[model samples]
Structure formats: C-alpha cells, structure tokens
Target: MANAHMRKKEPDKVRRSLLDRTAKLAVDQGPAAITIQAVATAAGVTKGGLLHHFANKQALLEAVFADLLKQLTDEIDRYMAEDPQPFGRFTRAYVRAAFADHKLGVRSPWAALSVTMVADPGMRRLWSDWLDGHLAAHRATDDTPLLEIVRLAADGVWMADLMGQDRAEPRDMTGLEPQLLALASRPPSA
Candidate 1:
C-alpha cells in the first residue's frame, strides 16, 4: 500500500534529496550525524515530512545504503558494457568503478555509506549479501588468481583512501589501470 508521501508531486525527488542529504551528512559528520531532525533540515523538509517518507532514522539509513549500492551496481554494469574483453571482464569493470567511485562528491557517496555501513551490522550484512551474490555470479570469469589479485589490489587502494591512510591521486597511480586491464586481458595463468 502507498502512503500520502508517495501520492504527492515528485515525491521521489524529495525522497532522493533526503537520501543524498543523508549521505552527505554521513560523509561530513559520520554516522552519528544521521539523526532524523538533521536529515530533515538537510533535505529542507519538516520532521513530519521526513517521517512520512522514512519511518525512522534506521529506515532512512537502510534506504540510503541501498541506493548507493544500486548506483555502484549500475556503474559496474556500464563499465562491463563498454569493455571489450570477456575473461576478467567483471574484475576489470569493478576496478574501474571502485577507483572512480572513491571521489567525494558528484554522486559519489561510497565513503559516507562505508562509514555508516561499518557502524551498522545490518548494513554490513546487506553489503556482504550483495557482494556474495555478485561474486558468485561473476565467479566463472573472475575466479582466476590474476583477476582476484587485480580486484583485491583495487580494493586495497580504495580501502586506503577510505581509512585516510593514503591520498588516491589517480595521476600518481598512472598506468595502474592499464596494467590491471592488461592482466585482466589474459586467461588463467594457473
């Protein structure tokens, strides 16, 4: 059943704004800043309005995490579509997407979502479930040691950025993507 919020004009627009604001807040202030009142003010909505869209802060956080995952999924799919190779295609696409997604703004909310994800067990489960399913789906092509290593390397870079351990200057990592792609271009070396 739908609610009054769903029946309003451009309700999805409002909902998206709320989610975006929530992600921004998460990145800027950490998970503790995702309160309903703060999210409402960030979205330029009333507490009642925010509540109408999201039952509670938890619900809103779940929705935001889910939305961010959806965006990443779409990005990976886009990269796969453009890729010319078959073997390790998924791995290659994932590396490009993950590195590209680490940016702070311009629709990139991974760092923020990652912070919230670490604090919430349920959200972590959501991520694990999604990752398990995705990896299982791509296992045929991405199971090789080379591809796995490449993917893990990409993860390491992203993780470093997430932990504020190292600045991810793409230029500094020059030729890195090509090297990964070249490795991904091969079949099982094992």
Candidate 2:
C-alpha cells in the first residue's frame, strides 16, 4: 500500500514539473524553443519521460493553449460574476488584461501558440468554431449593437497590440473604463 501511494504521487510530481518547465521555457524564449529535449532538460527529466506524457510537439502545444484559455476564462468568469458589468466594461477589462503587457516589442506567447495552430488545420477549425460560439453568445446579450461595436473595436485593439503596430506610448486606459461602460449600456439595435 505504501509503495503504491508513493508511485501515484510520483507521476503527479513529474507532470507538474514538466508543465512548469514548459511554461518557463515558453516565457523565456517562445514556443519554437520548446522542444521535448529542451523541456526535459529544463524540467530535469529525460526526453523519453516527456514523451510519455506528451506524444509530440503538437500535443504539447495543444496542452499549452488549453491551459492558457482555462486561466483567462477563469479570471474573466470571476470578474463577470463579481461585477456583472455592461458590455463596455467587460470589453475594457478583456482588452486591458489581454494586452496589458508593459514590455513593448516582446512577442506574445499567445500569438506564438496561435501561429502553431495555423500549421494545423484541425486546431484552426477548432478556433474558428470557438470564436463563432463566442460571437453568438455576445449577440444574444441585451445591448447587441453597442456590444458588437465594442467587441469589434476591442479586436482591432488586440490585433494592433499583438502585431506590434500600436507603437505609441501605452496610455493609461483607467478613465476610459467608465466611458466604455456607459457606451455598452446602450440599447440593442432594432
């Protein structure tokens, strides 16, 4: 019984260690640097061990995206539950959180994963489906047109932010939050 318990705990420890190493490597260098051997070395495991958990680079990339989405969703869900904000408020928070990095010229790991997905048609399809669902959900809300505009604007902001086109000094959007909230409260389009 004691041996079995230790054995069970060992895999969990290894799995977490692998994930931590992968995240650190991803943060330090980009997804392209996340080879199985590199992850194993960073995690102090053998390549065989890494492969045991993740069959290949594709699987590893998928896991990374899944983890990232779960984290973002959890934070947004918590905020929505606490405040129940208008659409603009929600958009502001989403943009601020998603593109709030202080460092300019740094390539986003999220974008790196997105590039990886582009190479895989299945993942591309999955993302398209997910976006469609999200858009549908937004359209179903009370302030449809205003929220839609806010959503579209927010996407442009994110694209610029992600693509490094927004080279201007990062302005504090602190005051704009309230304004966005007011705009979001507008009635849906007829």
Candidate 3:
C-alpha cells in the first residue's frame, strides 16, 4: 500500500522529465524530432514509460505548450504586480517579461516551445487563444492607438530577440522603455 502511494507521486516527476526532454529535443533538432521514442530516449525512460505519461506525441506537445503558456502568464503577472498602473499593466508586463526571458539564454524553454507551437497547429491555436484573451481584456477597458503602438513595438522587440537578430548589432531598447511607458500612462485623447 505504501509502495502504491509512492508510485502515484512518481508520475508527476516522470511527466516533467518527459516534457523537459521534449523541449530540449525541440531546441536541438527542431519540432520534427519530437517523436515518442525520441523523447523517451532523451529522458532516459522507456517508450512505454513515456506513453504512460503522455499518450502520444500530440499530447506531449500540447502539455509542453500549455506549460510554456502558464509560465509566461505567471511571469507577466509578477511583472504586472510590480507596476501599479492600471491602463497599460498587461502590455508593459508582457514586454518586460519577454525581454527578461530572452536574456536567459538562446535555448530558453519559451523559445523551444515557440518552435513546437509553430510546427503544430493545435499548439499554435492554444497560444493564439491565450493572446487573444489577454488582448481582449485590455481592449475592453482602453482602446487607444498609443497602447496598440506600444504592444506592436514590444512584440517587434520580442520577435527580434527570439530570432537572435538583436545579437548582431546589439541595439539597446532601455531608452525606449520609459518613453513607451509614458505614452501608455497618458490619457487617451478624445
């Protein structure tokens, strides 16, 4: 009975290990390499063990993508908590968190999950829905061009960072942040 109880707790660890292996494979060899056997091998688990945690490749990919989204949302929440502004908190938080993640290194989990998301339509939809929901929450309260511009600029910076383009020339965006924050704080012109 005690052994059964202990076994129940082990699945979560196994699942996490499988997900980490999938992300590493995606980062090293792209999404196509994320087969069940590949992930199981990478994780040092048998194929049957991997399947016990994730029924199939799609399930595994979905789990990884979902985990990524949760991490991003949590990071954004942390950043938003630091800033008291009500109007642009979400966008600002998103920008700050994304840039921070970029600095974590090139093979960040977010980048690996991005590759998987792009390769799988279902994963992409999951990301799109989360993004749309976040934008809707902000747009419902404030519909301003400046806010949109800030969102776009932040997205551009994030994309550039994700693609490692910024490393080529090292364009600094620190000066632009305060300016964008000021614009986000301004009352929308009637």
Candidate 4:
C-alpha cells in the first residue's frame, strides 16, 4: 500500500524542523520576520503544529536564539579542541568562527540576529550572559588587556561585515587571522 511507507510522526524531528526554519527566516528576513504565521509557513507545518512545539512567537524566538547560541558555542569548542596551545586559543577560534559565519551570507543566523541582539535588551542579555560565562571560564588564559582587545577587534570586524562596510571583510584584507592570532598568541606582559 502507498500509505504503508509513511513514517510515524516524531515530535523531536518536527520541533527541530521548526527551529531550523525559524533560524533560516531570521537569516533571510531578520528577527522581526519571525512570527507564528511566518515560521509555520517557512517550516511547512500547520499553525497548530508550530504552536505545539512553541507556545507563542516569543517562545519560538527564544528557542531560535538558544539554538543559534548552541551552534556557535559548539563551533567555538570544536575550533578550540583542534588547537593545542592554550594562549589566545578561544580568541583564535572565535575569530575563525566569526569570519566563517560571515561567509555563509544570508543563511547564517548570526548575520541577521546581530542587529536584533543589539536592538533587543533580552537578546543582548543572553549574549552578555554567554560572554560572561566564557570570560569566567577563560580568565586564567584570557584575562590580559591584549586578549580583550583582540576579542573586541574580532567583534568589530564581524559587525562591520554584517553592516555591509566596504573592505571590512577579513578575507579581503589578507592575513587578518594571522595578524589577529599573532596578537592573541603573544603572552601577557609581566
């Protein structure tokens, strides 16, 4: 029977799909585009189905933000895992991930959410919380002013690219990572 091949509905799968679509919408249309009707249409699910997974639009937005942050933290961890050196390691990984995310163009949730993160206090608080956690964890290695400057520079470059600034792209500048990593690699002054 044609109907026999159909798989049973899975809530987890459906929920993940909804989240993925929400991120995509944010990437394509900014956070303001994220609504119950819009996300449902994007996810190809019924309004009721989307609501089942997310009780409201605000809940859906928070879930999307959480999902994006998880993906970012995982990438940072992955990058950190590959580097043997402890000094400037997190900064290096963040630089790489920031530039790499930019290359993904409109599909990268960070690109769209950057503005929202700055515009919305709740989103900004989440971002600040993430930074606070990482800062606490890496204080031993990343407490120096030099490391802080490097991190701030990386943030600037990332936001610049997102804002469509000419010549803001790291790839276009040539050896940007090497330069940033060079600074990050230097040991803190005694």
Clashes of each: 0, 0, 0, 0
lDDT of 1 by residue, 86-106 (tens): 789899998888778655432
Between candidates 2 and 4, the TM-score winner: 4
Q: Which has the higher lDDT value, candidate number 2 or candidate number 3?
A: 3
- In angstroms, what RMSD does candidate 1 have relative to the true structure? 4.2
The deviation in Å at residue 146 for candidate 4 is 0.5
Q: Estimate, for each residue in 163-188, the C-alpha lDDT of model 3 and write its tens digit.
A: 76446676666676667667777876
Candidate that scores best on TM-score: 4
lDDT of 2 by residue, 1-190 (tens): 2243344447677877877677667767867798998998887767777788889877776666666666666655555566555544455445444544323225445555655666777667666675566556554453356665665665555555555535576545455445555666665555
Evaluated at residue 37, the lDDT of candidate 1 is: 91
| Model 4 quality (TM-score) | 0.87
Name every residue pair that clashes in candidate 4: none
Q: lDDT per residue, candidate 4, 101-121, as tens digits?
A: 767766778887777778877
Deviation (Å) of 69 in candidate 1: 0.7
Total colliding residue pairs, candidate 4: 0
Model 2 stretches astray by more than 4 angstroms: 1-9, 85-93, 99-108, 117-122, 133-139, 165-181
In candidate 1 the C-alpha lDDT for residue 183 amounts to: 82
How well does candidate 1 match the true structure in TM-score terms? 0.82
- Per-candidate TM-scores read 0.82, 0.71, 0.81, 0.87
